[model samples]
Target: MTAPLLGHMMDVPLLVSSLIAHAARHHGNTEIVSRRIEGDLHRYTYRDCETRAKQLAQALIALGVEPGERVGTLAWNGYRHMEAYFGVTGFGAVCHTINPRLFPEQIAWIVNHADDRYVLFDLTFAPLVDALAPQCPNVRGWIALCDESCLPAMKTPVLAYETLLAAQDGDYAWPLLDERSASNLCYTSGTTGNPKGALYTHRSSVLHAYAASLPDSIGLSARDAILPVVPMFHVNAWGIPHAAPLNGTKLVLPGKDLDGKSLYELMESEGVTCSAGVPTVWLGLLTYMRDAGVKFSTLQRTVIGGSACPPAMLRTYEDTYGVQVIHAWGMTEMSPLGTLAKLNWEQSQRPPDARRALLEKQGRVIFGVDMKIVGDDGRELPWDGVAFGDLHVRGPWVIDRYFRQAGGTPLIDGWFPTGDVATIDADGFLHITDRSKDVIKSGGEWISSIELENIAVSHPAIAEAACIACAHPRWTERPLIVAVKKPGAEVTREALLAYFDGKVVKWWQPDDVVFVDELPHTATGKLQKLKLRDQFRDHVLPTAAAASEQCPMEPLDANIDAHAGGGAHPVKSAATPD
Candidate 1:
């Protein structure tokens, strides 16, 4: 015991500014490309980015931005936005990224909630800023993220972004911020109630960036060029902005235009080696490529999240385009990086189909995250892969409390309940069955709407699908599927019902199917199942009618004709929904 333990290692604080500083000093030549809203490519190097970021920080200070105050950015991903990210945080002010996709009221509410004094917005959002300025009374001024020539006319007093930057000298000193000081603020999508802020600290952000750049994670490096199609406002673009700079990877930002054609051209021209986006964005790109008969030359991989990645989409990318799709799962509360679907040596050696099946599950947790499943009685379940329960997570980056919320605990013991029902296999793979709020309960048994929707959308004729609970007389509630067919693809309700044959239990099947032109989606591209549930609240299932009258209108199989295309491939079975 006397052999004194080497008194704890150096105590350098993990600050957000250090990431950019490291990039400038070591990887100064790395390029960052942005597609401007004016439909042109703007390019710069890390050194230039650092210089501009310092200028922006100086300008913000000159504008009376105080340390620890929140500076908001209501813009798309671009060079100016990146500069704001480092500038605000580097100068010890919290950078709050407001989602422009939210409704105008929500945007104003978020700004007011964060107490943001100033907002830096893109030219494309000038109209939006004009509309919100009246509602957001606390906002002192607005800075358009464009030069004087490009600045749009606004009703409020606006300052040109370049003019402000040009007024300041690049020489500036960054404050030595505490490691635990708040760095950024992002509000949840607020599907249920008013939006709540998730305040991120410098320590948590830097640590998350390091974990995200790990080989098993997003795997950023100097040799790679990453295009993050996920918006900057969404969980800090899933932490790609920080990870890219920390590892000195080339960054490509797509501004104001996420159309498939625009994205394809940008990726091909930039020589992007990898990209990340939600499944809907990829579906658009895939559809574009299929129609154009074009393939990527430099893109080697993509990370799909935000929603489940359809098995068909994964197969199409790998089998047709020679691109590897890495499945990832996260939430705004978890610093947006939880688990990445990278296979280990043992798993990589498995058969192709087996490996694909494994990838279908949301992979194991990366370092810095701890996960467990708990049953109804609050007992921790074993990782035997057979038991499903409420998913709970705790880690350096997971949120302990939402900002400004009073008088309630959001944690159980030390773990945050994720509100997702999932099972962890012996090998540590996480299979998410459904969100707790969206699961259907029939005859006191749980049915996963997510599972049913995944199966339904896999059919070639079906373009999108959503399942919601409908009232039933006997079962209390039953699943009703709302589906959108591909243009010109005629898929009948009976044929769709027959497609589920043998794939799921007979009673577990949807009681009825309804075809709709489109299903509603949240601002972030997730299916708004709550809206669908509301739309179908008064729907009466045939089962309810049969139970009431002792006779059904018609058998479910009546008029069912074998469709031209086969049904979806069987997914690996999981624990029966409770």
Candidate 2:
């Protein structure tokens, strides 16, 4: 016969309370440092963080922040945002992060869309808020993240964020949390379609945080000073804010200014060991270091995500800066941890250059996620790493449907279609070739825009490039290459086309090249291919006539740099939206 059943209560609240609550009982004297432009450089110990989060919870509840109501933020990567992150969610309210870089209308639309009752914004975003206030109807209060004297003179009802924190009494009774309660909500950049929210449950978020700290994952620990150059609005800053406390890592926030020099100062002063950001950010930093003679002898690791990280960029960091590049890939819907290309034994054994080549891949799928590639006929393909197909996945953390199934209600046996066309290697590494819609199909064959982009970037003369599907009459579609040059560098049509020689199928060469100042991007730094397609769709070399109609260009064998467009001197213009 069994004795009475015994068990430890399971809950996120319990975990957070232990982390912040009995500080000496769990993590005593652990440092939580935050820096902003002026005022006091706040230093909250783990115990202090706990006390303050509970206080903020009390303040939020006093302000009528009922469980599950949306609380939005338009702020930078600072303590104010961090407090809001924990305090709002700890009180069982949903934290909706509005991407401030989005067009004001888009920001207002998201705020109104979520029916957010209150907003906490960075002080630098004052004018933007002033312009958007009248548009967000449900928002009852606006809290600018500044000190009492720093409050901007504005027409709207603007209260200082720090003042509220100072006014909040440091005592709160956290509610009986429903682990399944919505904890955080973030929207995609809406490159392919309208932006939709991906609401994350507390359970999923906590699990992601746990998985993120594993040795095989980010492997963060207290000894490490972690800085996430990524914005908080982007999938909870890829869950770094929460994972840091769980892993006991000292966190760094760059605040409003995220330039390379600014980031460098923080990295040096904070003794930061690990950082993560999009490829564009590091590209700029690499240049900054070269010109300024800056060195990161202290930085050991960096995680690159958000877009395809070119191999050259990866090599520059690993070789010159003595930093290891950890390639990561995920989407907002996936709670953002899908794959990691960390160094394994075999991969580590490869020559540095070869290993850099492997790191260029999206890497193997992390645990808790299942991935597959399916042909147009909907048949699952082999993991040969060459046969590309639309990627579909499902997991406890990945979204089963978008915030609302906005991607056309695509329903399969149980998989959520991820739009990315990729191949899985025998080693389980997932290489994203291109978005299915961005791929160029000619004469019933598919050509990877990523393959072409990689080839284009290899050219010393070409600084960046983007490939879009240009209309072709006979073959149906061909790659129209848009490229940029280095400073004062000239690239003639023949010279650029010649670079593709002996690289890929001659027919795969771009039908025409357009010299563009820059390629457009969605709100989140992804190439806006749909817009590119619209801009060059009609300008492709007049397609070879069908056998029934007329002419055909010589087709044969040959070779090619992966190209990028977001490089120095990005020629910016209205890239007429698709």
Candidate 3:
């Protein structure tokens, strides 16, 4: 065998700190704007951000933070949290971003599991910090991401962020470290047991940032102002914090105000050209725009992910407001960027409906990622687009294993099982049909819950919808549509059941429609079907009965706000008779 040839090139590591330093050196004037917890917009340039980030690194060192130690943050998307993105990782420490939306117990468990030494939290989460301080004994200090005056009086001793920065002069250099050293940590929303962590290395994060900034991905550029309506605690705000700085694009952080009105105001005020978030957040923004009869002036595009974006939402954004919707899909495991639904030149020239139909799929993988589908027999499926199977992906950014090696090996034959049921067309576009566990098996055939839910939400009266499996006598399990209606909009179960006609095969149509006052969602805005399945585990489908009366409709909450935050959507109730 011939000896491996080595390329003669510079051996510089791809550190997260280098991204911010590059931005400061080249695009020092680019703004990092934040709607603060203190109830005002705070703005700074990349230069200022870099300097403070250095000071933060110095502060951490002064406070006895050691190399490779985990520093946890329970803050919103803001200037300080952005600094921590560079500072903590830059200082050779791991930046552990804890989702504040998780239960206090879960947060404490994560803190302990990560063995975080210092915890920094936004002022909005001060009370939460106080509650968690006693629980997280390993967290030596609790620092508020706020000024001294703005800091709330907590039972635990909390340090002020400004004070810590003021104590240090920006005189630190990012250390040279191995590219594969762990730099960031994020836990998956442990739906089954305890949440497991996805630890990211400097090399993977930097590579992810580069790929995510590509034209086919988020298409970031210097001229654009980007607002990450996605929480920073959630998959690094879908990698916008890094990509924005990498591209010298203006970063607009909407702190805590994820509701429709607040986000719309923030985007307009900042002249945001591009934004990224889940479907529920966009639902809020669209609701606000429709109610106010207003259109976005500067907003040109949006990246929707964290859940399957309904086609109706995409059409409304593009046709009504001239905003192009970039459908995206990823998980906490893959540095959270696997596929983006960008149309190729040929596909772009297609008719509006045809183009949208293509975009409704999860989209194609960017460079650095490889994906394939496998059937139950473990054989790879063909790319004919109709043959659905388990989606598996392997790439430089995807996790080889979980942090602490919690769940054993998640890969199968070198491919990471994405827990998604998908199909890849010959053109290489990936279409996510349903989650592996969420797919309903009626009789011997498989049914896509996502397809049914998408069709349900397409109905004007439906606000949000979830399709779950219901126990059956013959079929073993049948499709059930548990939906929420828009305020004051009345749609009977018969009408909804009939609405599915012609759109899908007769057997694939949901056997019953059960409306609820609200639907549960995960912290990242994904529909929580597990909870719904449990809630309706004993539900008796009307079809099974010989004769049944019409199901009683629950009264709609007159002032129900669909755009409300907190991982739950308000919905109206109406069920098919048993």
- Each prediction's whole-model lDDT (CA): 0.80, 0.70, 0.79
Q: For each predicted model, how many residue pairs clash, with residues at least 3 apart or on different chains?
A: 1, 19, 2
**lDDT by residue (tens digit), candidate 3, 1-578:** 99999999998999898899999999999999998888889999999999999999999999999989999999988999999999899989999998766567877999999999999998878888878988889888999888888878779998998999999999888888899999999887653356778889999999999998999999999999999877788788878899988999999999888888899888888899999876656766776787788889999999877655556567778888999999787777888888888889999898978887789777899999999999999999999999988889999988889899645888899999866677899878887655555655443234567778889999999999998876443343568899999999999999999999878667779999999999999999998876887788667676633111211111112111111111110000000000
For residue 337, what is the lDDT in candidate 2?
79
**lDDT score at residue 390, model 2, on the 0-100 scale:** 83
lDDT of 1: 0.80
Per-candidate TM equals 0.78, 0.75, 0.78
Give lDDT: candidate 1, residue 441.
45
* Deviation of model 2 at 306, angstroms: 1.0
lDDT of 1 by residue, 228-322 (tens): 88888777888889999999999999998888899999999999999987655776787678778899999999987765565666777888899
Put down candidate 2 lDDT per residue, 1-578, tens digits, no spaces: 88998788753443233333443235557666666756345666666776667777776777888988999998878777887877888778988888765557767877887889889888778899898999987898998877788887898988776667778877676566777778888876544334667788877887777767877677788789898887777677777887888867888888766777878887898889998876556765775787788798689998777655555566668777899888787777778777888767987898967776667787877678789999999999999988988889888766665554544545477887876778888878888765554544443233557777878878887888888765433343467778888788887977888899878667678877778887798899888776776575346363432321321112211000132221110000000000
Q: How close is candidate 3 to the true structure, as a TM-score?
A: 0.78
Misplaced by over 4 Å in model 2 are 1-25, 39-41, 351-353, 404-411, 438-578
Q: What is the lDDT of candidate 3?
A: 0.79
* Clashes, model 1: 1
